[model samples]
Target: MRLKPVPVEIEKGKINVDIDLEEGKTPFIVVYCQGEAKITFLPEHGETKVVTHQGKVKRVKFDEGEDF
Candidate 1:
């Protein structure tokens, strides 16, 4: 199955991404950024993952709003 890419909005140096996924499946997201970038995932369980990748692109796996 091919899922549509979620829309990401960047405003004032902050990036906002809202994604919806199906249950019992794992989905990955590839984000392209210039230079170094930091990504933070805030889940419903109050667990947060802060990731910093120094490159032009980053690929992260998502499972039930879990960490990367």
Candidate 2:
């Protein structure tokens, strides 16, 4: 069985993402949105690592709304 990836818009800054899913092939929810999103997501434990999206793809961890 398979499920469609839900489309979501993450604002620039700290946003809490608490959702559960089965362990297997999963689609990314950020691809729908354009630009460099500095998401501090640690899939290991689902811990909250807040970071901002910077202009550069390398610095995508800064809170500045712009496509890297």
Candidate 3:
């Protein structure tokens, strides 16, 4: 699946993404900067996956009210 980056506001900076996924496919969110990254689902319904390009990845959970 092609992951697109949407506009996101982080603690210090902003993130922009454009993802291309097939229809019926689950929706996911990925935040990355430099080499570190974080992936979270739409809701807290599923597990979040953390991945690092060379160092470490952090998983964060957000509520629906925090979304746009």
Candidate 4:
């Protein structure tokens, strides 16, 4: 359970979040879009997706928050 501060960029109508993790480490991302922005994900079993490799980039269809 570590905390990281990552920068997000919004382009067109999409947002991108990136992660940099060490070996044998995993992360859980929870994002909530604010204002006139809306976001969604596929295969939405949104919770506890783990990353288990060093310098590995894993993608998941995790959607846990809502926008207004």
Candidate 5:
């Protein structure tokens, strides 16, 4: 199956995607950035939901520490 990139808008730090699916059921791909991200998909209702969170740090830089 071929996946198409859908246009998204970020409002209040949340991303919303609107997709139009053809007749019959199909699967689509969803991309998310790092940090803290939440996702919700509703294929039966022909809609997908995505939520992202900020202000969270994943890694910290150390001067005398070994990088793994």
Candidate 6:
């Protein structure tokens, strides 16, 4: 299944996204970043009646690091 990309705004040095998922389905997110950037997912989870999604953006660093 091809999921359309959703644009998220950076708020207070962070980003938040909410999407619907069907029950018993495993859903993943595709994060696209421009230029030199890093993304880290923190150990966190939120659950409701049916869906369970985890994590948050920890930090994004764009600096001189080891060549990739």
The CA lDDT of each predicted structure is 0.41, 0.33, 0.50, 0.38, 0.41, 0.37
Q: Which residue pairs collide in model 1, if any?
A: none
List, residue by residue over 1-68, the lDDT tens digit for candidate 6: 23334555555544455545443334444454542222223212432121223544333322323434
**TM-score attained by model 4:** 0.29
Clashing pairs in 2: 52-61, 52-62, 52-63, 53-62, 53-63, 54-62
Model 3 agreement with the true structure over 6-59: per-residue lDDT tens digits: 556667675655444554446776767654444444643444444454564433
TM-score of each: 0.26, 0.19, 0.29, 0.29, 0.28, 0.31
Global CA lDDT computed for model 2? 0.33
Return whichever of 5 and 6 wins on TM-score: 6
Residue-wise C-alpha lDDT for candidate 4, range 1-68, written one tens digit per residue: 13333344445554555543454334345433332222222233335344434544343233355445
Candidate number that wins on lDDT, 1 or 4: 1
Tell how far residue 4 is off in model 5, in angstroms: 4.8
Which pairs, if any, clash in model 4?
A: none
Worst 10 residues of 1 by lDDT: 41-50
What would the per-residue lDDT of candidate 5 be over residues 1-68, giving only the tens digit for each residue? 23334444455555555655554445444554542333233254333433334743333222233345
Cα error, residue 64 of model 1, in Å, equals 19
Residue 68 in model 4: lDDT = 50
lDDT of 4 at 28: 43
The TM-score-based order of candidates, best leading, equals 6, 3, 4, 5, 1, 2
Off by over 4 Å in 5: 1-11, 23-25, 34-68
Cα RMSDs, all models: 8.6, 12.7, 9.5, 14.8, 14.1, 14.9
Off by over 4 Å in 3: 1-25, 44-61, 65-68
Candidate 1 global TM-score: 0.26
